[model samples]
Target: MNYTLHQLEIFRTIAQLQSVTKASEQLFLTQPAVSIQLKNFQDQFNLPLFEVVGRKLYITEFGEEISETAFKILEQVQSIKYKSAIFEGKIAGKLNISIVSTAKYTMPFFLSDFINANETVSLTMNVTNKMAVLRSLENNECDFAMVSTIPKKLKIERIELMKNKLYLIANRDFNSTKKKILLKDLNTNLFIFREPGSATRLAMEQYLIEHRVTIRKKMELTSNEAVKQAIIAGLGISIMPVIGIKNELQNGDLQIIDIKGLPIETNWNLIWLKSKNLSLVAKAFKNHIELKKEAIIQQHFSWFNDSN
Candidate 1:
């Protein structure tokens, strides 16, 4: 602290604005205080830093050189501070998180593991569809979002958490009649789907469109539980994440059809803003989620094999 960091900060601000008065206004100090600091800086340099000609203040050549060096020194000091924080293992903060509706089952269990290890940190959770999660990231509402669909042109940075697959689910009665069915054959049956902008629903629609299959009639539901209820009630069939329907599928309330190219495989990703400053808590949460996501998925959906 030989050369006060505060002095360099004031000098940099003054250099940027090219006006002592404006810097003082922004820093919440009086004009006289800014002037005194500037005079102190000049005294330390043993020279005049600025030449005030007319109403404008212009920096001298020596002042320009000092300004450049000051910025570099300040940046280095900040880098050291950041590195020191990471080494100190100080994990105590709240992290705001939003995830796709289906992630409610898996993400919480994974986060529970983190909570067990770090008793100091707390989590605030939001379960929403992909579009809302993307909106949360854009608006700085959430520190990170867990989603299957990637948004376009949003400047989001995504890390692949794990591979997740979408499956065609039906009531046990439907499975008893036809253990195996064709995609073209299922076109005549009524379809239950998630609402628009849902990544899983979108993927299912894309697959149907690609295969030239159209449903006889369609019903849109808000939650996976609702969709599963509709299917188990023998109302219609729907496509959803395998992880989301594990319990029912295992309990024989619902079953997956062995159809060729029916279930679509996809990756789950954690996304956040590229420009926002990631807090220490947020960074720690992201690292923990990404590093342990795969194992969590496996633990929850161990019955489902990775093989095609």
Candidate 2:
């Protein structure tokens, strides 16, 4: 019956991380301090929030319900703080953003400009896979999420940021001739693929499926950087976002294969839950992105136009 916002925050962090040790590190508190707060939080409810199994923490059904409520409370509190800051005519608050790993190549530039423009604003950016980003948005854990493919099932609003063009990339030495390849020809080569649940992988799979292309030998990598490296090592070819491979493409370490029906084009979308209240800082960022999207693309992604 008696608990503070701080205790609720601790509980939420522990629940999200599923590890008290990690929660402590994220909160900048000692493990014992985090444990004490969590204990106090659970004592107030007189019920177990989580269970430990084989040294791993799992949230119970009741714990999941409570955690959802805790998130709503925290969001409302933040909304109130943002409203106060608005009345004071100051744009300030923490902006939590979740970005799919592939967007890491371009999102940072926009975020840097936003941060530089608003000195009072703080930021927490979580770079993760597409599924994780969607989950973050669904759980109200982040103010915005940037991804290539927008899920049809989630009740969220999205704005197109730019084009996401994925291309088949191979080691420069693989083919010395500047000859375009056919999509059907790709099945013969080993293909390096992004991990399952990745937007890039999903896009690639959809395209291949539609074209009736099946890769018999494939290597799955968890990160774009790893996939690029693996391709450079001649492990296989991969379909990667052009934004993430611009540097390598320019350096001639990797070459975008001129393939018939290549460069799967998708839009980069900025998404947020429709029901969640946006903080002042979050609103500012949304505006900033809209206003500066074209200029940002021109500055950092001009190559896109030239390549296309």
Q: Which lDDT values do the candidates have, in the order given?
A: 0.81, 0.87
Best by lDDT: 2
Q: What TM value does model 2 have? A: 0.72
Steric clash pairs (candidate 1): none
Off by over 4 Å in 1: 1-89, 175-179, 294-301, 305-308
TM-score of 1: 0.67
Residue-level lDDT tens digits of model 1 in 50-89 = 8999999998888888889899998787666656655777
User: What does candidate 2's lDDT look like per residue over 97-144, in tens digits?
Assistant: 999998898789888888987766878999999999999999889999
What would the TM-scores of all predictions be?
A: 0.67, 0.72
RMSD of each: 14.5, 6.0
